[model samples]
Target: MDTSIFTDKTIVPEDQDLIRELKETSVLWYAIRNHVHGLYPDAMDEWHYSGVKYGWSFRIKDKKRVIVYLLPREGFFKTAFVFGQKATDVVMESTIAPSIKELLKSAKVYAEGRGIRIDILDSSLVDDVKQLIEVKLKN
Candidate 1:
């Protein structure tokens, strides 16, 4: 089954749809989006439908470089990032949480970078995601 809340290819999710589907977690969603935009004025975001398996996702990018992919779920969202060797090493060494570090370590290294998807169930993981975005921008 498709994990994303917005699975219908014909229907693109609007702000109200996300707010309704995500409920309280929608606050976190807006927080992160605003945080990214605040930090990087030129950052651009777009929605993409990656077939049936993955469904719809919102991608935030800095010009040509992708910063993160926000996947909307029923009550929460997942942030995906691709970190290069330097950024991965930085995250591994930082004080971001053991579980997240492990996720990065175990993620398969592709031509772009090591991709990891972090589920944002609550506000606890929001800062971590923002820090990771900074790492992505710096390295």
Candidate 2:
């Protein structure tokens, strides 16, 4: 169990042992972790919405605007993004994977926003997730 991999402590659970085990199980998880922490080192904010889910805030100032939520599962994880109305159009225009593009189109837009979930089952998907995040962040 180690705390060194943590970038935002607010969302991370107290069970360091569990986090360490999850990190060891999935390499894709590590890639996502590195990208999130490395992309916004100082300004990164996190909130654990529930026992097994945590969201990341890619905010402008301190408004607590969460862009993505990461949910860890068996040997993989899903990154969920709730894009605003404007961003949804941009996402439709972006050059993301065909599957993900469909996900974006069909995601329900509610009181919060349009939500889409991308499962990080392989390292190859990291770039797509990052691209989607960039679009969501801009929104």
Candidate 3:
């Protein structure tokens, strides 16, 4: 079986260096995939963001709605989730990790919702990220 990522742009697929970059992150990405895909098997989509400087957004979509945005980093990845007032209350009430709660507390509030970004270094944080996903899906 051939496991490779084909980019949205022909320009991207043609670049061997870009393919290698994707390959380098494959292990970590697979760790992420194991957790996310287990819960949201159908949420997978080729929803790559355009002109990303650092890495890509691995979005889990439910029809037209976006559940979460997983941004890949050098040796880690960041999960972006937006929570409304009610969801914020839920997060505050939940027994998530202190660091994650601190992140929630400091997250910038916008008109739409409070945007929370969490960086995950290893598979250990997958459960927390999933909880955040539950918060995102709640609303």
How do the predictions measure up, each by TM-score?
0.95, 0.70, 0.71
**Can you write out model 1's per-residue Cα lDDT over 20-124, one digit (the tens) per residue?**
999899999988898889889899989999888878999999978889889999888999999989999999989888889999999999988899989899999
Q: Give candidate 1 misplaced runs (Cα > 4 Å).
A: none
* Candidate 2 lDDT tens digits, 8-95: 4454544353355456445665556566656566445444433212332122222466656666554555777888888888878888
* Candidate achieving the largest lDDT: 1
Task: Supply the global lDDT for candidate 2.
Answer: 0.61
CA lDDT, every model vs. true structure: 0.90, 0.61, 0.64
lDDT score at residue 3, model 2, on the 0-100 scale? 19
Residue pairs with clashing backbones, model 2? none
Query: Model 3, 38-108: lDDT tens per residue?
Result: 66777765446454333335677776667786665444556778788898888889988888888878888
Question: Which rank order by TM-score, best down to worst?
Answer: 1, 3, 2
On lDDT, the stronger of 1 and 3 is 1
| TM-score (C-alpha) between model 1 and the true structure | 0.95
Better of 1 and 3 by TM-score: 1
Q: How does model 2 score by TM-score?
A: 0.70
Q: Which ten residues in a row have the lowest lDDT in candidate 1?
A: 1-10
